[model samples]
Target: MRLEQQPLSQVPEKAYHLPAGTAAAHGYDLEVTPESAGWGYSGLRVVTLAAAEEHAFSTGDDEVVVVPLSGAVSVEADGSHLDLAGRADVFAGPTDFAYLPPGTTATLLSERGGRFALCTARTDRHLPVRYGAAADVPVELRGAGRSSRQVRNFGTPDHLDAGAIIACEVITPDGNWSSYPAHKHDEASATESELEEIYYFEIAAGPQGQPGLGFFRTSSSPGHPIEITEEVHDRDVVLVPFGWHGPAVAAPGHAMYYLNVMAGPPHPAAEAQGGRAWLISDHPDQTWIRSTWADEQVDPRLTGERS
Candidate 1:
């Protein structure tokens, strides 16, 4: 399935903001393929299964990582079997995952059903099937004060041995902001890499189990102008083909979590540098924000000092 690329001049206003259930297909709650996204790489799928149920698919030309959003899952691929000890929920902590190389058929079965995120990127390289332990993931607390957020670098270049996909998870406490300083990686140069990005979000509910919401923003960049500012909810996704995007803000009573998927062409200057680098340039006007973090302390909730 291929979709003709829409000229940037004619890109739809709402094309980047995919609301929950809007992109459902192939038995997945949400499916965003490179073809469907009008980009060359980066895709994501959110799937849910019942107890004892299974889902199977072929990797085709894309390498994939099976990340459990909730509950445990058993994965079988390329004659290899992996049991991911998933967490109770996203906020429960990092969960184990399975990486399936390209050109393989894989099956996922859960004794006690749950939701899973399939993060993918188109690539020609065929690596081996491997499992990533939750304990091995590097968790970083970035920024400070209201800008503080927790980042789970599970499938980043320095950590995982993969071809094109660079994925991770971020959690921003309620009323906080993340992905700040408004950065852009739309230009391929000595300082920046041109990568298309996908943000799949999940907001935590309020004390009474009320629905949660957050906000995301993206503004115009030099040659690639785009604009997006929307209230995002659980399962909502935002595509960043180009532009300066930042300050994903969690509402006053709702913490926000998002999975980031990115991929792009390799830099010619550094052929050995697999297409796994995440180089970005902060919006000049807001670059000064980084200096403020030196004086402020990280949010207590993220430092385990308080709940």
Candidate 2:
């Protein structure tokens, strides 16, 4: 994998899209750091382990959530141990996750080989480690018609107990659109919040195990300089420091899964409040589509069934 500095004037697509082996290290299949992303907060690491393989790390100054993308695992953190009953894969359904506070050390062991995602964000607060059950995850079928998708709000601000970071996983069925209407969260105000987002994608294969593809777009906002529209595949990542991003569309015969990692500036005098929120401003031209979903039925694929 090549590691080089890129000028700020270049298109973001050139630096985004870290392929499968481009960022591997320390038993991780993919790793993205705040410094590597040229951002202040947000990071992700995907680790794959063989049966009985063990991996451990300390959070240092970043809080982290260990989410299983496939198979079950045992997590030991801050003197407490939790065995997570994970799912067969991302499309199987919502899996249990463990959140580790900043500065805590944790070890993960998978008796059965599987892939896991470490969603992280830098923060100064030291919250307690907690476990989230799959049953507790809210399965939201958002949008309608071709724009429909399933959102697993397992770690979103309104659902989880955390500081500084807000995360979620979205599943866009075949031929569907998600993150629609294009939206921006580049300004700090009552209507918008400044945030950095990480999109880690995994494309599902067809019934016969055929490869699939998808499309993603991010356009420059008022003063921010970033624009990209690219073809995406499994394990590809798109970093959004600032921009209007949307319309992540999955191609026919294949479903798409993307884990969204986001975090922004801490709230003023609300550091101890334990409340988290994300504000977005939709693109005026496409915002009207929001009214259309009211009459359309959500896609039947979002049946909220666990495999």
Candidate 3:
């Protein structure tokens, strides 16, 4: 990836689609900061540690959530210690997590080694450090048929109380699609909220352990026009500064998983509303797809049954 500064027109494609290892920084395999994204709030860092290894860092001005992608880990932050029971892989279901407020120092150690995702958001409000148990995460099955997907709401505004960040995980079965109907949240209004988003993906391997692949699309949205339709693989990332993004499709036999990190300024009309929310507007032409879901049965794979 080019590191030297260049005009957006000169590096537009590279700016949004980051292949594996292209965004690495600060000892992490993948790092996308608010500064790096040319945005103000959301960030994500992915790291893998060997058995008995330790990693430490200060939260600085960002409130962060430590999510394990695999293996177990123990986190110590703000005078508190918590053991996170992580999953075997992203396809293994939800895993516990730890939250650390800004300006705090923390350490993470894995007895058996693991891969972790640090989701962050720059904020002034300092909430207390806390642990989110895997069992407490709400898993919702959304859409139906080809659009069916599983959503694990762990750090979403309605689930975890944070200053600005809103996060969740989506699992789309092979040959299905998620993030459909093409939506945008690039405007701040009573019906929409402006939030920058980061999509970190992981594609489950094939039966013979071959690499997996998928696709992602982000198209123009009014004044905040942009476009990206790229083939994605394990550990790849897509950044949405402003645009309508959707139709993340997993190729046949390749299950897909993505961690979404989002954060933005509070809506002006929300001073009395008392909560940050994710409000979006779907593409007018594709909005009709939502109605079809009402008549279709959800894909059995997402209902805890084998496909």
Candidate 4:
């Protein structure tokens, strides 16, 4: 069955509508409505924190990913303090991504605060908040035979066996491709795998103020062909329901960025079903991962009026 899809371009550029009185008198950030209809009850949206506000952000009944699109911020969890300021200056390092698992509480302070986009998953799927540092964590190169690169994989280098929900953030360099060839893990077969996916895109303008855009093509089936050509800016997203989604496309002008939030019906949930898999077929010419380490990651120069 074809699912209801929403494209960022098709969606009118609407300002976030925060309920009146929601903003506290003191340093408090406003939350934007994460309105999307693709994955069943799962919630996805963008929450922006202001500079003047030093809100103590936390989560409840859901797994959340705290990603700073731009600017410096401080994140504390499990009695550990991690500073995300000037990380880019440190060898083109990335902004830290904090995954808040169920029942975990934390506080965020934005000294020179700007805005942060938080993607939360609402379901029985529980992902304990994990804080992984790109500078500290060792990246393992996976995917052989034309596909090769490092995956955070979590603090533990192990494959998911319980159809557990996962949140992964990768830094794709300029003119380089991530996600590589088309692959699907919709089946819950043994200790190997089972899961569905939702790709949320966040991009900064490429070099010379060139807009960063992501390319995506859906399988040519009876369902629908969902394509993204919106010249995505920061805080833009494209939803995938059923199809072979690949080549998390990036243009030569800018390095494309995205966070993947995934969850699916595990085999245990489907007692009658043999396995869990709803992956559609993919087109030809869409196969490649990594072989070379590529070039250095140039930071995206944020320009053209910071919204």
Q: Estimate each model's TM-score.
A: 0.96, 0.93, 0.94, 0.60
lDDT of 4: 0.46
Question: Which candidate number would show the highest TM-score if scored against the true structure?
Answer: 1
Error in Å for residue 225 of model 4 = 7.4
Per-residue lDDT of model 3, residues 239-258, tens digit only? 88878899899999999999
Best by lDDT: 1
Clashing pairs in 3: none
TM-score of 2: 0.93
Can you write out model 4's per-residue Cα lDDT over 97-117, one digit (the tens) per residue? 666665556777776656665
lDDT per residue as tens, model 2, 1-307:
1123245445446686676578787668988888788767789999998999999998887899999999899999989999999999999998999999999989999998799999998888778888999999988888889999898988877688787788999999999999998998877877787677999999999888888899999888898777789898888888887889998999999899999998877654343445356878998889999899889988887876321
Per-candidate Cα lDDT values, in order, are 0.90, 0.85, 0.88, 0.46
- In candidate 1, residue 183 scores what lDDT? 96
Candidate 3 vs candidate 4: the TM-score winner is: 3
